[model samples]
Target: MSGLVLIEPTELYNILNQNTIYPCLSDTNFLLLLDARNKLEYDESHVITAKRARCDGEENFAIPYDAELECKTHVIIYDGNCRSLREKCRALQCANRMATDGSKNPVKILRGGYEDFSAMYPFLRTQKIIYLPQELDAISTYPCEILPSILYIGSKEQATSKAIHKDLKVQAHLNLTKSDDVFFDSAESEKYLQIAIDDDREADFGSHISKIINFIAKNREKLRTILVWSDQGISRSAAACIAYLMSYYKWPLKDAWRHVKSCKHTVRPNRGLVMQLSQYEESRLGSKVTNVDDPYY
Candidate 1:
C-alpha cells in the first residue's frame, strides 16, 4: 500500500493539461499514461496521450521504447473499473510492475479506472494513439475538479462553454466575476448564482460565504455538480471554493486551502480573501491558526 498510489481522474486531468515540473525529458516522455485494458477495448477509446501496457513472453511488463521509466516524472496506469489495488486486475498488475521500476514518483493507478474517468470527463476520451508536443500544449482547458463530480472551479470562459457543461454534467453555475453578463441562459435560471466582485483586496467574500456554501450543499444533496468560476479561475472563485470547503467539511483554513490547491494548481486567493478565510476559520475554531501574511500562502 505504501508503494502504490491511487490518483483520481481529475488529478490526472490537471496533470495532463499542464507542463511537467522540472522534467529530464519532454512532457510526452516525462509523463507516462498507461492503459492496462486489453487491446480491443483500448483501440475503441482511451484517455488521450495514454499508451497501451504490454507484457512480454516472460510475463514481465514491456517498457515502451524511448519512455524512460526511471526519469519519467509520472507513470499512471488504468483499466476498466479498477477501484482497488487489491484486485488481481490488469491495472494492479501493470501498476505493480512500474512502481518497482525505480520511477521518479510513485506509479499512480487511476482510481475507478476508465469507466469512472470517461464517465466524469468524457471530453478527454480519444482514439488518437500519439500526440505531438504542440498538440499536447494546445489541449483544451476546462474547469478544475475540486471534489470529483461534486464541485469544480474554473474561468469565465469555461463557465460559458456549453460543451463543458454537457460533458462534465455541470448542473449549477456560481459566478465570482465582475461581469454584468449572465453565464447561464433563461432555461437554466434555477441553476445559476452570482457574486459580483473585483479581484482587489477590498472585495469582501465574508458577507456571501454563507450563501455560497449553502448553495453548494443544496446542490450536492440533489447529487448535482456545481461549477464555480471567476475572471481567471485563479483568485476569487478559488477563495469562494475554499470557503465552501471550510464550512461543509469543518476543516481549518489551512487544510481547506491545501485541498483546493491540490485539485487545481493555479488556485491562489488574493490577500484579502485569505484574511477573510483566516477570520472565518477563527470564528469556527475559536482561534486563528493560519498566518494571512505568510509568504507560504
Candidate 2:
C-alpha cells in the first residue's frame, strides 16, 4: 500500500463540490472516478461521474488512454468491497503503466469502497428511499447516524417516523423543531424533549443547551440512544449537538464539529449558532476559543 492512497467519502464530496464552484479547476486538476464494480451494478447506480472499469477476467481493468483522463490530477476507483488485494494490485499496475506512458496521474482507492460511499450519501443509490420533509427539502434529503447507536442526526421526517425510531431503537429524542409531532412515547426506558425553535441565524438556544446536555448525561449511564433533529437536520439541531459535545466532553468548537461531521458530513451550523457555541466554549474554558468560520460541507 506504499503508493496507494485512500480517499474518504467526505473528501471526495468536498472535491466534487469545489469543482462545481470552479469549473476550470476540474479542467486543470481533474478527478477521474472509476467504478470497479461489475457492469450490471455500475449501470444500476454509481458515483455521479464514475466510469466503469472491469477488474476481473478476460480484459483486466485499465485506465482509458484518453488525453482528458490521462491528464487528470487524481484518479479514484471503488469496487463493491475493495477488499481484494489482487484487484488492487491490478489497478495499481494499470496506473503504473499509465504513468510510464507519461500520464503521471496518481491513482487511489475509495476507502470502504462503494458501500461506504453510498452509506454516506444514500441518495446516490438508484434504489434508495427519498425521505422528503416539508421545510428545507433540499437539505433534508439524507439522514445520517453521527455516533453509531448512541446518537443520530437526521431530518424532521426521520425524527417523526415511528418505524425509524423502532428500527434504530432510539430511547430518547431531542427535537429542535417548532412542530408538535411526537415520535417517541413515554416509557420507563425512554425520554423525549422538544425545543420549539426556528432555524434562524439569530435563534437563541442559550436556555435549552444546558437542558439538552443534562438529558444526554442522565441517559448515558442507561445506554439509551438519542436522536437530535431539526427541519433539515443541518443547522439548529447540529449546532445543539456541537454545543452538547463541547459542554459534556470539554471539546473545543472546531474539534466537536469535526467529530460530528466525520459521521454526519452534511451538518452545517449557521454563523449565529457558531458564534453562540464559541461563546459557550469560551465561558466553559474561561478563555477565548478559536472561532470556526467555514461551515461544514
Candidate 3:
C-alpha cells in the first residue's frame, strides 16, 4: 500500500467513524493515532484513541509495539501545532522513516494537528468541550452548520426527517440531488425546492445555482432556518452553500469557502464545482479572483 505523508483531520474523523469489520483490520485495528506532544498535553487533551509519543528527546521517536499498531492499516502522527515549520518537518521525517522501514501500512502526519482538529470539532476536546444541546442535535446529525441563521448542510436523511424539521423549525429546504425524495409539502408552513443535478464534473449547475441563490435571498427575511441537503451531505450541498454565501454576502469564493468550512469541517466541493465557484466569484467581482487551494482537501 502507498504511504501518505500528510492526512487531513476530517479524513481521519471519517475513517474512525466507519463501521467496517475485517478480521485483521477491524475498526479499532484499522488506525494508529499517535500524539507527538508532551505527556502533559496528551493527558489534558488528545485525539480520541490516540497514544502519546515524543519527538524531542533522545529516545523520542519510537513507534509503539501495541497489537493495534501491528495490525493498523494506517498510522497517523500529530502534534499540537502542525503548521509550524519545525513540527511539520519532524512529523514528515517520522512518517518517511516508517514508510522506508518496509512497513506496508500508510503512515501520515495530521495537517495543522490538534489545534485545527479541535477548532473543527470542539466537542472532541477534553477541556472546555462544547456539547451540543438537545435542540441542536439535529444539526449535529450532519457534519456541521454552514451559517449562523441555523442554515445547515446535512444528508438526505436529515432533510427528510420530520423530527429534525420540527426541532430546528426549518422554514425552507433545498434538495440538490437528482431524486424525488422530498419529505415536506408546499402547503405546509415549510417551503421546499429541488434541483435535479448529478454529482459529476460535467454536470452544469449554473442556472440552478442562480435560482437557489435567489430562493435563499427571497426567503432570508421571512425564514429562521433553511436546510440544504444532498446524498452524503458533502459535495453538492456544500457547493450550493458556498455559492449562496458568495452571491448573497458578496464574499469571494476563497473567503466564503473558508467561512463555510469553519462551520462545517467536512464540506469539500469537488474540483469541478470549486472551479465553477471560482468563476462565479470572478463574474461577481468583475475581475479574476485568485483561488485559494484547500490544503486539507
Candidate 4:
C-alpha cells in the first residue's frame, strides 16, 4: 500500500470523508481519538492526550503493541516538528511495511502530526474496540445422542477434540501451548489423542485440508456429525478452507456455516470473510438421525 501524507486536519478529514467504510470517522465524530506522543506534551495541554504504546522493541511479537487499542482503524498522530518525529515515523513505517507485506489489515498513519491537528479537531474518547462475550442459552442435561465417530482437524489457534471421544464427553483444546508453556507438563492433554499445531508456525492449508478429507472419508459411517471451530470466527483462512472443502462434499453452505457458528465450545473462526460450505444431502450410512438440524450449513 502506498503511504498517505496529510498536511492538515482538514486533509485527513477530507480523506476520511470519502472513505465512509473506514473506522476513523466515528472516533472523530465522538471525540475519542488519541494522539501517540509524549506524556509531557499531553500533560502540558497537547491537542490530544497521548496514549502510550507498549514498547517491547521486538519487531515481531505475536501480538502487536496497539493490539489492545479498541478501535478497528487507528490514526497515529505525533508532532512532525518534534525530534521524536523520526523515531515515530520509523516505527509507523515498520508497522505499515508488515501490513502490506503480509495478508493482514493495513495500519494508517496521520501525516500532519499531533501538534498541527490535535487542537484543530475535537476528539472522541468513548468509542473503543469492544467484543461481547458469548453466553450459551440452551442447556443439554444429557448429551444429545449423536454420531459416535469424529475426525480431528488441527490448526494453530484452536484445539478441537476428536469426534469419537467428544461424544463420549472428551475435550480437546489449543492456543494454551504459547511460548510461556513450552516446558510445562502436557501429560493430561496427551492422555487423549491430541494433536497440537504450532500457532507461530505457518502450514499449507491445502495439504492439511486434504488430510482432513481423507480422514473423514475413512470413518464416514462411524462419525455422526462434524464440528468445526477456530480462533477469529471467519478470520482463520485454513479453517475456512477446510469448511469449503467439506461443503464441496455435499454439505449445505448455510448449514455448515451455522453448525460452526453455533458451537459454543468451538472457537468461532473469522467472521470477516464469507465461507459457504456445502451440506451433506443424505445422512451418513450407519448413523441414525438424532436431530433434524442439518449437519452442514
Candidate 5:
C-alpha cells in the first residue's frame, strides 16, 4: 500500500481496456503512464499513449509537459524488462522521481515492465503517441475484465469479435440470451454455453445458477479467460457473473454484487434475478445473507 506498487500485466490491461469499467484512458487526465526506457526503444513502440520519461539512470527524471502529476489518480511506469522494484531499475528510478514530485498514491511499476505488458496485451501496444479525445472515444471496445485473466462480461457483439477472441484468447463463452442465438464457431478449443432466458424478472433462471458456476469453475484451469454475455450485457449476463462469484468465493450476495458492480458500473441484474441470488445465498450457505428489499442497490 506504500512505496512502489507492482502491478501485473493483466491488471494493467484491464484498466487500459476501452470497454471495461473505467472510461477510455484518453478520456481522463487522471492517469499518467511513463516509459522509462531509452529514447530509441521508446520510439520503436511502447504501451499505448505512454509518454517518454527522461531518466539519467541515477537520480534525475524529466517528465514530459510538466504534467500536473499531483492531479493524476493513477501513475504507472515501465521500462524494457525490469522485473523487481527492489532493484535500482530504470522503472524504479522513474517511479521514485514521480513519488518525490507528488503522486498521491504509490507510483505503480508495471511487473515485468514493457516486455510483459506488451506481450500480454498486444492489441493495446501502439506506435502512435498523440491522441485526441474523440479519436480514443471512437476506438473499438473490449469486454469488461471482471477477474483479470479469468473472467470477462461483455455485449454479444464483443463476444463475437474475432479480434477480442484472439487477443484475450477467451476459451469459454457463456451466452445468457435466447437458446437459438448461437454466435461462435467454438474453434481453437473454445467452449460455449447458452442460458436461454429472457431478461424478465419472472424468468426461471434459478435452475441454471448451479450449472453456470459449474461450467466456469470446471473449465477455469483449461481456459485463458471466460466471457459471459447477454445481448446487451447489463442484465442477465451480469447476474451470471454475480452467481459465479458467490458460489466460487462463498461470498454473500451483497458482497458479490458489490464486487461485480464495482468492476463494471453498467452491471444491473433484474429484480427477479436478484431475488434468486438472494435465495441462493440461503440455500447454498444455509443462511440469509442479503437484504433483497434494501434500497442500496
Candidate 6:
C-alpha cells in the first residue's frame, strides 16, 4: 500500500502544518514522504522532504513501503482536487501492509490540500516547476526537442484523436493494424515507458517489469511523463489488473489514465477485483492514515 485512509481533515492538518508543536517525532530516524502530484505541479510546490514518489518509469525500483527504517513514520501529500493524490494514498496503504506488524508509522495528508501547504511552507515552489510560455519560439523550442507523445493504434483509434485534437504539445495518433508486441518495443525504445504486468497471472513479465523499474530507478533525473499503453486490447481485464498493481504502489492513476485516454485506450475493471483491492487497503493500513499532506517527511 502507498498510503493510509482517514476521515478527519483537521487532525491531519495539525500533524503536518504546525510542525513546531507536533514536531517530527522521529529521532535519528528517517521519514519518507510522498507527493503524488505531476512533475509540473510538484515543481511548482510540494512538501515531502526525503524523497518524492517519482515517476515509476523514472524510478528504477519501487521505493519499498517499509524498508531500511529506524522509524515507520511516512507521510503522503497530494493535490486535493486531483484524483492522483487519493490513488497514491491508497498505494501507501498497500506498502504499509508489507511492513512489520504492530507498526506505529503515520500516513497523513494536508488540510485544504496542495495550495494550503504552499501557504505554510513556501519553499516547495522551486523543486521542479514547469511554466508554459505564451508563445513558442521555433529556434528555442522545436517539435523534436521536447518529449515525443504516445501514438495509439487500436480499433477505436479515431476516438483518441478527438481526445487530444487541440493539444499541440503532446501528439496522439492511431494505427489500427499495429500489434502489441511491436507497439511495446517501439515505445520502450523510443518513448518513456512503464509496463505493469499482473504478478499473479503474467509472472512471465515479472522480469520485464523489474528490468524497466531498474532502468527508471537508475535514470530518474532524465525521464519525464511516461507513456502507459498496454498491449492487452479490448480487455479491461489486463487494464484493470495492471491498474490494480500499479495502484498498489499508489502511482497517480489519473496521469496514467489521462495518458491512455488521450490515446483513446480503454480501461475495463473487474468489479470483484477492484473491490478486493479497496478492501485490502482499508484493512491493512488504516492505522497510519491521516488526511494531511506533509511535504517534507
CA lDDT of each prediction against the hidden true structure? 0.81, 0.65, 0.67, 0.33, 0.80, 0.35
Better of 1 and 2 by TM-score: 1
lDDT ranking, best first: 1, 5, 3, 2, 6, 4
- Candidate 5 vs candidate 6: the lDDT winner is 5
Stretches > 4 Å off in candidate 1: 17-26, 185-190
User: Largest TM-score belongs to which candidate?
Assistant: 1
Please give each candidate's TM-score: 0.88, 0.61, 0.52, 0.25, 0.84, 0.28
Least accurate 10 contiguous residues by lDDT in model 2 = 128-137
In model 4, the Cα lDDT at residue 79 comes to 39
Name the lDDT of candidate 5: 0.80
What number of backbone clashes does candidate 1 have, counting pairs of residues 3 or more apart or in separate chains?
0
lDDT of 5 by residue, 155-215 (tens): 8777778888888888788888874434454352336777789999899889999889887
lDDT of 2 at 238: 88
Q: Which ten contiguous residues of candidate 4 have the minimum total lDDT?
A: 135-144
lDDT of 2 by residue, 107-183 (tens): 67676778887886654555321222322123212245555457777778778777666656778888888776575
- Give per-residue CA lDDT, model 6, range 1-297, as digits (tens): 233444232233223322211124232242444555555666655653424445455432244444443354544444433223244443333234423323245454444555655553343333532222221111111011111222222222222333323332223221212234322344544333434344232233323433444433333344432323333332222333334334345534333333333322233433433333333334445532322123211
Query: Model 3 clash tally?
Result: 0
- Candidate 6 lDDT: 0.35
List the candidates ranked by TM-score, beginning with the highest.
1, 5, 2, 3, 6, 4
lDDT of 3 by residue, 1-297 (tens): 346566666665544433211111134456666777777787888765566765556534765654344466777777776754345455565565555554567777888888888776555455322323332222234334566445777777677777667655677878888766556554543367787788888778766778888777766767658888888777889889989998888988877887777665567777777778777888999875654465543
lDDT of 6 at 189: 45
Q: Is candidate 2 or candidate 6 better by lDDT?
A: 2
For candidate 1, write residues 110-229 as lDDT tens digits: 989999989877888999997676666666676778887889888877788888888888888888886743547435646777888899889988988988888788888989889999
Clashing residue pairs in all predictions, respectively, total 0, 0, 0, 35, 0, 31
What shift in Å separates residue 189 of candidate 1 from its native position after superposition?
6.5
Candidates 4 and 5 compared: the better one by TM-score is 5
